[model samples]
Target chain A: MKETLLPSSIKNKEKRSAVHAKLKQQKKVEKKRNQKVREAAEKKALELGEDPPPKKTPRTIENTRELDETVCKPDDEELFAGNDADEFSSILKQECIPKILITTSRFHSSRGPDFIEDLRSIIPNAHYYKRGTYDLKKIVEYAKKKDFTSVIVVHTNRREPDALLIIGIPNGPTAHFKLSKLVLRKDIKNHGNPTSHQPELVLNNFTTRLGHRVGRLIQSLFPQDPHFNGRRVVTFHNQRDFVFFRHHRYIFETKESKTPEGKDKKENKAARPGKVVARLQECGPRFTLKLTSLQNGTFDTQGGEYEWVHKPEMDTSRRRFFL
Target chain B: MPRTTTVESPGCPPLRALTFDSLGLVKVIEAHDGQDGGAVKMVERWGDPDSSKCVLAASILDRESDPLVSVARKCGSIEVISAINGDLRAQIPNHGDEDDAITGLHLFSKQQSESSSRACKLFTCTTKGHARMESIELGGTVAEFVRDPSPTVWDVCGSGNILCSKIDGNENYALFGGKGVEVNLWDLQKCVKIWTAKCPPKNTLGIFTPTWFTSATFLSKDDHRKFVAGTNSHQVRLYDISAQRRPVISVDFRETPIKAVCEDIDGNTIYIGNGSGDLASIDMRTGKLLGCFIGKCSGGIKSIARHPQLPVIASCGLDSYLRIWDIQSRQLLSAVFLKQHLTSVVFDSHFRKEVPVPEVTNTVEEAEVIETPAKRKKGFKDEHTSKKKKSKRSSKKRLSDDED
Candidate 1:
């Protein structure tokens, strides 16, 4: 006999309502921001003592695209290999993280989706730009508002990229990248200036293949078959949303957040303590293969792809080790 | 341990295509399917001693479940690729450790200079009329696309470089000769200017198309590159790669023109297929016909491939038969007939099963794609003008867009 886990429908509905309301509020904010821009232009004109030109009404077609696009909304926890749990919590309280964007070139002869399938293991809360169609301008817009921890770019071939990996968590505004560009090292305080304890990792001689020409005309072995396509989807996928989450007993990393409107409040719930970076992108390269207990969840596109309130529980390191 | 072995099964799907590389069997590709250009399956058999044969993948879609017509294929040392993903992959039985799949199929393609950003890949051709190539460094995904605009761009050169042969599907040739007389030196991808030279002409007593017998190689002792172009002209022309120099030695043989020239017994002795279908042994250092063991055959000898480890020479000709001839004794050890009349032949070390060629029948879809007999008569008037348009290689615009 297998255990059948059922989610609380009331909680889900509440989360959905909050998200929808937030979206509407964001739209109103955008309209106000546009008026501010208009006012700012008029104030400058008044300072110069010159009459401003008449504002023209924008023309539009009825059948136009309807979607929000913003470039940098950082996710909840931005971890660039930082070990300080306290520092991350304090950063979250200040509320300033930027979303990450990872874009690469597409080859002339092939099409496939790989990185989108394997990202759950790395980042806790992340989503990809799956808008059915590809639009760079629109993608960039989403990246602006997306909360991201870090952006990692990789390539399968030499000249150009075969894929892109982006992880967007929340801890932004400023990161340890500005502190020292090091991994898991700290700063030493002294009477005057404090010397850093962890030196920045050796990053010299590191080359990234981002924007390069890729296709059969350039490569001697140009006539490549596609990586993945419709047939592949039919063979492998259980659903459009093949989302899985795993909790490893040995390693703990989680992002914590509170329910909005002051409901079901708990004392340390809002604090993202000991939580690892939540990633929006899944299906990527693996650094090391570790055993973990994974759980699967059903996610429908009926709601928006980004559900902020559906934030995962906080993750912490193991308290005790037997071996 | 018997590291390498070649089996001859008479009842196997009459071998359609065969290609051989240095390590032995490149690929024995088989194509089957009648509906929708006939579905295809490919299996990779290996000849390397340590590693076992590894199964590649299968890509086939048959509506009627019948075999297909003749399909061209390419084979190489590292990888094997074809225009149609057929059922030829079933022949390669799986074995060995995970990493020890098949040897890299495109091993022949070497980097000339770092000037270009992309890595140059090489492929091998089997006697089964199949061409195969494998990705070298950028290895994850490798697939070729057949453009409707540039339809007949399929072609393979002496260098294992796969390119478009006929621009608009005519006989736009870059390599042709009587027993491969003139070895055409072509920078096919760059200049596209074909440099032809008079080497050896096929002397198979005036029968069949002439094939080239040149195998371009490098001289390790001097770090120099050269080519040994064999001709049915009873001569072998050696060209130095440094200067695209003239022939170093045009070795004329005794009594027969060179039809087939291949490496034998450590690259010292060259196996020569003479004009009279005679197999001769010659010393590489001094081009001397040491022995003319086998006297004659019914068909003109066109192709010859040496065994990877054994002193064996596999030969084929217009007779539609492949014979594995021994160098020591002029005896026919094993022989097999091909499914169709072959254009060329090579022994692939990766050949596993002699899969039976399934019977191919016309499908309703193929009938619809092609014009009916009554309409085909009227089509000629319009076809004459269309033929000229179809023949031009530079015309890449789709017919739909070009109608404007």
Candidate 2:
């Protein structure tokens, strides 16, 4: 269109930087000639059988959220009898085993004991402690008198570790979170150490009801049988409410290239020639969490009972959310 | 009259309520006149999800002609049931051989008996301080094996714990409170105690503040000497008992532990909730606060009720849902969920009043067009009078709280 009136009436010193690099090379050749005429009209409308164009959807705030009538309806028998009577239902029915404890927030720093030693090697029977001058309600009454079925804490601030808490033990629902992008395990990249077995988890979306009680308080911090031959795992995922975490380990391999480049080349010749693929690896200590406040027992920051708190006017709406 | 014909269905105003949870289930919700998320209905569960039959204190006798409810549990019995078809009817053992626990149940009515029957009672209390009562009866114009099951117990506050009670409004005096216990009161026809409170001083860092009390009530409707309570540290307080035994107001709110307080039938507001799902509403004659109640209740509100002629309010807790709200636009007019943790709710108030009452007069004309013209200019400076006494004395001074 006359190069948008020829680069602002070519007013500059070096002739308007050569007409703004010739109008950005004529708008990258008119956007690759309009993407090769929309891929030759979608390959001549699939060789003329017609109907090949309806693809656009991308408006994501997790597919425009804001409807949430407490979601969780996969055959909700009163949300499975309220998760078979909560408080992590006796370590989720394995009839009790959790343990955890972990600690930190009391003027602690050095990357908060290296992120609670990478969350005590990704939470199994966890342990850690040393938050010296006590008082997280006295380490939740000394981890509920040592039977500690979860406590966590972490917290730090300038040297990083930014906040975590958890709690649960001896009648509690605690939670708290907010920690952020950490990385640890010697800053990742090909990382992979984990193992004393237990890992497995996964979790993902957690669909509402306060993301299923913060996904059963992060599934009562591990251990209810998950040694999957230690191929480790540990996910948490939960998209729009933040969570994320990660860690991995799988293996399988075999399929190196059967035409796997990009655009479906006829669905890559329907793969299968020596298939196997799996792979994964990155077992570092990445992080994210978000929650902010769940409380209900245990660590009483002066009276405890909050079953959900995170407010800034509950973020008004960018597709509102609350895990 | 074909059940007085009404069902005007457009959605929003047919509530019913009844809750009670922590596993010994009980549900009942309802919501009809069309919808807006309703239908809960479990109606009876009672323990054995592998022990700890929880249900720590319930209540709902809705001035019975049949309804009933009671609950109590944590091993100390009480039961009752019947709110229409959930049956059971009686039980009553309480403080079950003494390991203590029940923490307040309530019911109340006790008066009829000249063989025409009626009676009522229940009460309960516990977490060590005990308190009992019992009666029930109901049957009337004769025969259910000549009724009378007997219960009595009433040691009232022989020691601490107590958790919370209430009674008042002419049921003569009850109050209680808990944790390190403080607010006392008692005298439900001579069960004793009478007035106690006291604590509050120290803090210029001199520490002191601890006398727990997690939830108490009675602010008005026949006073019994004022009171309010809440605490476990999120404070609230109020008290009075004919002027100062301590808390003549106090305040705090919002670090959690208030767990349900209620008050407002124009008793100078109150509400509370806390333990985190924060419900708010304060005032109690200027100790102030007020706003909160919009949506957020993931759990911990344990029971709020309010609707003795609907301005709404329901609540429930530990996030098993139930909600309701609309105390003049404190909003959230309907929620439901009902999975478990609940712990007590109530409000049946002749629910669909003989089938509808024109969907409760079209929800009092959609709560008077969703209220808020600065609360209809602080109670009718003449919106042409009698909209039922200006919506019942401008929705009788509001306040409510939950999360226990």
Best by TM-score: 2
What is the C-alpha lDDT profile of model 1 across B1-404, one tens digit per residue?
21133222212221234533212223344432332232222244333311112112111111111111111222211232321222221111122223322211222223445663123333323321133332233211233211122212222334322211111011122222222234444342442535555433445795543443423222121222444555433556565545554566667664444545565535456666644355666665666767764422433455566655444566764333456555776555445443122233443332222223333533442343232211111122333444655452222232222223
Question: What DockQ does predicted model 2 obtain?
Answer: 0.21
Taking the candidates in order, what DockQ does each have?
0.00, 0.21
Report how large a share of the reference interface contacts model 2 reproduces. Answer: 0.60
Off by over 4 Å in 1: A1-323, B1-224, B241-246, B254-257, B293-296, B350-404
Reference-based lDDT, each prediction = 0.33, 0.72
Per-candidate TM-scores read 0.27, 0.33
What lDDT does candidate 2 reach at residue B220?
Answer: 80
Model 2 has an lDDT value of: 0.72
Docking class of 1: incorrect
Candidate 1: global Cα-lDDT? 0.33
